[model samples]
Target: MPKSVAGGTKWTYFASSNAQNSRSPEVLFDLLVSCSSEQGFSQVAYGALTDAEPTRRPEYLPAAVTVNFPSAWRERYAERRYNAIDPVVRRTTMQSAPFLWDQLAHKYQLQPGEMRVLNEAKEAGLKHGVTVPLFGPFGQLSVVSFASSFDDVDPEYRLSRLNALAWQSHHTFAEIAPSSEGKCHMKVALSEREKDCLRWVEEGKSSCEIGVILRVSENTVNFHLKNAMRKLETNSRTHCLAKAIRPGLI
Candidate 1:
């Protein structure tokens, strides 16, 4: 049984054990519902993107999606193809930070269609929410949104707790519903030097130290690491190592 905190926040630790042990989608959905409800959100949605060009536009529909919103609202959203104009989907592609729904207007100049989507969402009972964006080992993007009926939600306090639950939900879903596009199993080829650099990186080595150990210049070590990152389709050193290690590329 999962234990609840005093104020109904921070349930990730309690749910994590079950999340890791279970491979059922129903179990994952139930966990999401329970955790979101505890935190005051009445609706929750999870969407994953795969096999699409890594663009910052909301042109592609999520390859996989699950939501607990009203059926009427869901039907309307799909019928109108609102994903193409959804500001939240667009923002998820551009960054990995968690954001409040109300903050979108302040961050970007909302287009007419995007503004309409937000406005219609409010009328559908999704007045306030926070969306947490998760990036996979591949360039895949997953977003989890927890929406509330009221406008007085405290985003700062809820974002961190909800973010943890979102990640656990993502991992559980990924295990049960592996990507059909085969991206997760695709093999990335790295040169001998690149693999060597990444192996050193896995050992907690700095670029300068790795250069000394490999008898190469610091710039040369960085060059190899950057190449490894490109081959793995990742942006940062940490992401590079993680992706490389996942497929045993290193």
Candidate 2:
């Protein structure tokens, strides 16, 4: 065991098992916080694929409170809408790899409110955090984070171990995130045609472009897309991509 996490090892089992068994995003968040607590960390947050036809924010699980960040900071973050300016999440969106806090400091300067949040994060004793981005079937992207305040901790080791944990949890999360599609519940089950259509869309294909490649009419391509959306229960192509890919549909 690494010395930074010596006394906090119990969290390992708790998080892994809970990650394995989570029935919903709420359950997952609940487990994430529990694990963070065991590791002596004061904060943790995560977002995952949700069942939304058009893939709106409401379909995504609202930020569930797992740790106690100052309510004032939370209010300010929401009020000022820092999510648009959040460098951490933006970076997460770009990478398949996990990220650490230090990597962002040099590129993005924190505004006063953002800095206050960062300071709070630091004060909570968080020396480091690991953000794992999980990619699913269509174009689904989800992030799982584990953090700690103990400065003595080695983030590399934690990230390596936690990434394995993240994969396991993602698989489990996929199983539960979609609740309506009996056989296809949790994961998206895409046919070859549907998968092809979605893949083209991800590559920025217009229906006509996709039709040209598939040797079908643009209307045919659109039909496949609509079928895919129906199968994924997504109202729009983008949501379908996000959900299908996350659930491993493609």
Candidate 3:
């Protein structure tokens, strides 16, 4: 489909559903995380899945921008570094449409590895879901997935709303996610590594711990931190970490 064809989908009503005028990426990301519930999803996960599919390598695990996932599920996802096998990740890499997870499951025969991830997610309370594949102007690919307990879902209505939401999210994210990071916009650029480092900081991980997790040297982690501090304009690590997290830079 022509990108604009999807881009032009009307979301005027969706925008007005909330009276918020602040396009602060922080507020927007929080709203995006919960908006799926309005469409009847019990849980939602939004992310900046890397433009390139993650090769099962430690170096790229930190590149994903995920929000609002269940804590336990997120732990398992990271422990396993599931991106290399996540069906949603594969679909977002090529699609700009909102699709059912079931549809994707059927489209590709799942390897045992993929099936394990899906089953764990199901046990984690995500019984049914739709993924909104959002594409930014400069070819960045992100996604917002909505899920719920097993129940009848109105595919047409839900996907229509998700499609519209995907388009809106793409533009909003592009506008705030620094241009240098992938999409050019209103914010200052923070290298993906810097964002990743700060996110680990928020998780209470030390530089050495993060280094082990992300497969970089502690010195490299410190280097990214110093650079993030320079870009964020705060001298102390705590303040810089706070700033990076406030607008969801992680």
Candidate 4:
């Protein structure tokens, strides 16, 4: 059968459903991971799958880490530092929702540098991939992705299945994985304004932009952020985000 058109009502349905219920990241990831088979894909990973806790600083695992993508591939990608050139990772860092191959493939023309990386991925049998970068309500950045060997696949069907599975995956993981690092031991409470400010920050908004959006002065925005930082007991905005996510304050 011919591949279904990607930009259509079917795709809209998936997008709408995902937007309506996004309370759980684990459920979303699990759903994406489980849909690999039906979507004609293989392997899926969200968040750092590494148990290789650092030695001297055993507590150095950042709240944000690369998800699945074979150990060997990761090493090679790092050795060559392909991540800087991998447009998917770079672009997805800025988006809140999931993204399919076509969106990236079409949005940015593959420059020579990008083509080389794409060819490398293709050679490794990763022809198509979908990435969902979840910026947690707190400052966590978790990426869930599915890879496949097929190009020009039926996106409508794949998205339909992916959409169906994302919620359940998000819910299950959140329930089992608590908001805090110790799961239950670390609890940081934020005021409503603090939560609001941190959530927008995680989405990559600046104080000025957030002020405009929230109809508050930039100083007011900064005040909320400052209060959030004080409550979270973090030094910088990035650390504040990480701490918020680690403790599930947002």
Cα-based TM-score, every candidate: 0.62, 0.51, 0.56, 0.48
lDDT against the true structure, per candidate, is 0.68, 0.57, 0.61, 0.54
Q: Write the per-residue lDDT of candidate 2 for residues 1-250, one digit (tens) a residue.
A: 1221221233235434555455555665555466545545445655543332211135332442132444655566667676666656667767757777755676566566555555665665556777777665566566666767677767665554455445444444445545323124444567889888877765546799989988999999999999998876656565565455443555
Task: Kindly give the stretch of ten consecutive residues in candidate 2 with the minimal lDDT sum.
Answer: 1-10
For residues 3-48, write the lDDT of model 1, one tens digit per residue.
Answer: 2221122323433455536655656676677878777886888776
Shift in Å, residue 250, candidate 4: 25
Q: Supply the global lDDT for candidate 1.
A: 0.68
Which ranking of candidates, highest lDDT first? 1, 3, 2, 4
Q: What is the lDDT of candidate 2?
A: 0.57
- Winner on TM-score between 1 and 3 is 1
What TM-score, to 2 decimals, does candidate 2 have? 0.51
Per-residue lDDT of candidate 4, residues 180-213 (tens digit): 3312244567888777776676555689988987
Model 3 stretches astray by more than 4 angstroms: 1-23, 51-61, 64-66, 180-250
> What's the C-alpha lDDT at position 150 in model 4?
69
Tens-place lDDT per residue, model 3, 1-250, is 1121122212223333353355355565556655555666746665666554212224223654445557778788988888888877776677745688767668888788888878888898777778876543355556667777656766455665555554455444454544523222337678888888876665446799989989999999999999998886655554465345444565
Clashing pairs in 3: 179-184
